[model samples]
Target: MINDDAQTRPLFNKIALIGVGLIGGSFALSLKKARAVEHVVGLDRHSTSLKAALQLGIIDSFTDDMASAIADADLIVIATPVAQTTKILSSIYPYLQSNTIVTDVGSTKADVVLAARTSLQEKVSQFIPAHPIAGREKNGPEAAIDDLYVGKKVVITLLAENADQSIELVAQAWRLCGAIIHHLSPKEHDQVFASVSHLPHLLAYALVDDIAAKPHADRLFQYAASGFRDFTRIAGSSPEMWRDISLANRTAILEELDSYSAKLQQLRASLEASDSVALEAIYSRAQTARVNWITAIEAAESQNKDGGD
Candidate 1:
């Protein structure tokens, strides 16, 4: 029999990571960082990815089969594309232990919660819909870093079916990964990210697409500076992933797109009329708002660090 101390020491005896890309890879490394889990078994269909993760010491073991990987895992993290969650969760449902806890690192949560509800039925209490508001344009196991979630905002979308213990464990795990937990309903999570995350990505893709369609586009891009690169960075993100997020949060994203379109039309009108005051007002307001946001975030981070110390 396992020692009582050993059983209680590990936050989880084994953590089964369903998708060993950036998020999932980072999660494994983070648990190791905090000494939270005794073992990690990572799953990815990519044989090369599994090998690389094992070589990098990101996982204790790796596998491609869904059911066998999660058979005895106490915690399951499904980090696949948002659109794949339903299918993946359904496939793994039969193998999950009744005491196992499930969570996802999807960008959107409303549909994820729905997927869990429909797939797990009465066992929905075992799943927690979570989104870590962090990532780069780069993905895959190679891009994973241990500190990626440090000081990041992790939103937990509270569901009616979620049990108190399940919620606490999910929240505590994120905290162990050095994230600050925030609670929201699935609807609220989707709406908030649709504006702040999805809308910006859509704008970036549109801007790049329009720029590329211009005559002598290559010449124009050759002269592009930091401002262009910074604004369009997200346009370089995975097309498959963004496509899923766009459709998954379609209603809220469409609302944001329409609002942005109106703003663009207003800016165009101001430029056409050569309204210097209006243009300056828009620029000044944007600059002020962004600077204020940065300042507030920095202050919060400092406060959190100080409090932790």
Candidate 2:
């Protein structure tokens, strides 16, 4: 349990956030709301994103120069797309301070961890790979919300000899934003998230693509409603971002995809055979699973509030 008094402690003297998109902007907003950092600086390649971040007052300052942005930061968050993480680490490696604690909001962990270990080993102890299981289908700064990570699960993948203080600081920062922190190794993190997160996104993309490829695609889309909209929502996410994540966690995602495909085929076969009993059983199981998941979420939320108090 986190000490409630510790919640008032300033986590970082200066925090540098790279890529002011949904995740980065949300972090800045949460930090300001909790007063977790004395200074927050946003860095992005896009001038428009930087300008909008400033206009939204998500950060105290903005810069395009990676080094200048992270120069004296006590905590640095790489919030760029997964594909850009390795390159960003290479660019920011030379400027990272000795005691600086660095983390990321990338969806995949194995590749991000590998990049940091290979290019920034000296800073590896401070590089804690993290992924917040919270986001909308929307992209960019305009889609960011202060409570984006609120009540979401944030997974932290720590290095073998990671500093305890750094891990604690990262956990505190997430908690301040109303997240439940969970610790996992890079391998376990990749596997679990691949099944739960990456696989779903892949299915969403595939489903929407399949529908869009139909001859009457435009006319079919006109009939889409709440169910179609909800299921295919993540298909609207940035293609570049999803592309990177797919490649980064390819192995685990493929395995899950195969399993999901087999299950889907079985259901399709049952439907074609008019096996109402099997279809009914499958729907019943899905409904029960959803109910249990909701109950678990409510329980966790209750616990988080109690712990915060």
Candidate 3:
């Protein structure tokens, strides 16, 4: 159980946010909003982002030195891209304190867990893997919001080496940020997100790329409407970040891509055969599923609001 005094006292004396971008910046802001952290130290290889984080008050201070940044930190959050997990964890290993709890906001978990196992080795118990199911299309510290995780879901994948006390502390920190926690094994998390989150981003990027590569790209873009804009909005996200994510979770993503390709082939066959019944059956089912999912989401949000009040 979390301490009842969580509401009145800070959960951590200091927090180290290794990457002060959207997710990390927002986490710091949310913790400050909840009065759950006394100090936040931001670390990033990009000095420009570090400057932005300091100016925006996303962190109490910014540092390039990993040792200084994580020194005495009660919690350390590795918020970099998934591909950087191994490097970041290895760098911190030398300085990581036994009492400090380490967590990450990576989208995929299997690879991260493997990286933790490889990098942290026997001390892997101090590391807890987490993914916050929330973000905006925008990036950087300027895009962060204090309420980004409010009413949002955060998935936690526990390591075999983890202690119950360490797990609870990490969970309590996120709870203070207003994130509802869910548990899953690393493989389950990667598989689920590959289908829902990763695949969608890949499809959006592919669609946009296909159109942009055509000779009439400018004309098509000039006439592009809300549907195109809405569908390809994710394509405007950081390509570098998405590239890392795609490769990191390629196994699950490839499986999902194959499944999506089969569905697309069925649509193509229906169109070629002029089978209106088949097409309508597919469209109707998709529409109904979308509507039902949205309805459930809205209901859940409303319930959360009422409960909070």
lDDT agreement with native, every candidate: 0.88, 0.86, 0.92
TM-score of each: 0.95, 0.93, 0.97
lDDT score at residue 212, model 1, on the 0-100 scale: 96
Using TM-score, rank the candidates from best to worst: 3, 1, 2
How well does candidate 1 score on lDDT at residue 185? 89
lDDT of 1 at 236: 93
* Displacement of the residue 148 alpha carbon in candidate 1, Å: 0.6
Worst 10 residues of 2 by lDDT: 1-10
Candidate 3 lDDT tens digits, 115-170: 99999988899999999999889999999999999889999999878999999998
lDDT of 2 by residue, 1-309 (tens): 223555665667788988889998998888778877778898888989989988888878887777777778888899988989888888878888777888999999989999998878677787888999889878888888988887789999888868888889888899889888998888898899888888888889988999889999999999999999889888888899989999999999899989999999999999999999999999999999999999998998888678767
Instruction: Tell me how candidate 2 scores on lDDT.
Output: 0.86
Best by TM-score: 3
How many residue pairs clash in model 3? Answer: 0
Question: Candidate 3's error at 175, in angstroms?
Answer: 1.1
Clashing pairs in 1: none
Assess candidate 1 and give its lDDT: 0.88
Which parts of model 1 are misplaced by more than 4 Å? 1-8
**Backbone collisions counted per model:** 0, 0, 0
